[model samples]
Target: MSGPKEPLTRESLEPVPIQVFDDHMVLRPPNRLKERSAKRARTDDGGDRTVISRAENALKLLSQEFDAWMTKELDRLEEARRTLASAPSDAAADRFYRSAHDLRGQAATFGFPIAGLIADGLCIVLERKSEISDPTPLIDFHVESIRAVVRQNVREPDDSIGLALVDRLAVMRERALPA
Candidate 1:
């Protein structure tokens, strides 16, 4: 409705005052990509070697404690299984599922990927039923397989025994649960 608006210029624009709240802090996260790119540009190689070395060393240190952590988790899972066996209630089933679920999520990180697979199969079976009336023998098989894998240090996915156990469980799960 009015005449052509004037273009925005540095001199014409007035600075608005910003009030800082004492309770809340405003933070701007640094652009990590830009920082990484800058570091790469500054260095002769593509990226920083020291940072990668530090990360690898930290992972190695964590790996040293992984076996103990895995054992503790397995113990918890076994306890849950025992509880499920004795009680055979929804609550006990839930606890058992939770234990299996936790192991499924962390088994690979704990250097027992085969155990993770067995846990996954167990989770699938448990997930199929809301209230497990009688815990299936398949459940026992899965749990025992997980324990065996961890105990035997069967970390690799390609281990013949581990693969066979996983395959057998998969077939059992399919037969027990169906689609």
Candidate 2:
């Protein structure tokens, strides 16, 4: 094809002297050049470093405190349930439900999903029976179930069964309430 069209060559395509488009055009070095780390980076001062370390230490302490608080709440819920079993009164059931609700909130925050879910369901059951029934066996069952769940070290609450039970309890409570 006509000697390959002279290889489609360009006369000035090779490297040559740079030319300015205008008189005030300042040349800029390529931005892709590697930067010196010392020029771009800062050395951490002892004060700033210590502040960060102290913040981390504070967070660790707070986490430990929160864990302890959650454990105490769990123990309190267990005790309240036991007391309800012995007395079998509306006030006792109410106290047990309140304790269980607190335990559920704390356990959920602590990532104990199994305990949280069981406590949630138990709370609903207690609320429904708070005014009239002797809810000792139910309270004991809930306490044991929660203990077993805690022993198993569950990370997330299983909400399906708990939600179902909560719904049933809600309907029962609605029917029992004054018209």
Number of clashing residue pairs in every model?
0, 2
RMSD of each: 13.3, 22.6
Q: 1-179, model 2: which lDDT tens digit per residue?
A: 45664565453444544557766545554333254222443466566678799997887677767656767887888788778767867787778778888877777666576677668767766666555465555556667767766665655445565445445544544555433
Q: How far out, in Å, is residue 79 in model 2?
A: 1.1
State the number of backbone clashes in model 2.
Answer: 2
TM-score of each: 0.70, 0.49
Candidate 1: misplaced stretches above 4 Å? 1-41, 44-53, 130-135
- Local accuracy of candidate 1 as per-residue lDDT tens digits, 80-163: 999988888889988899999999999998889889989998898888854444447878888888988887999887899999
lDDT, model 1, position 28: 49
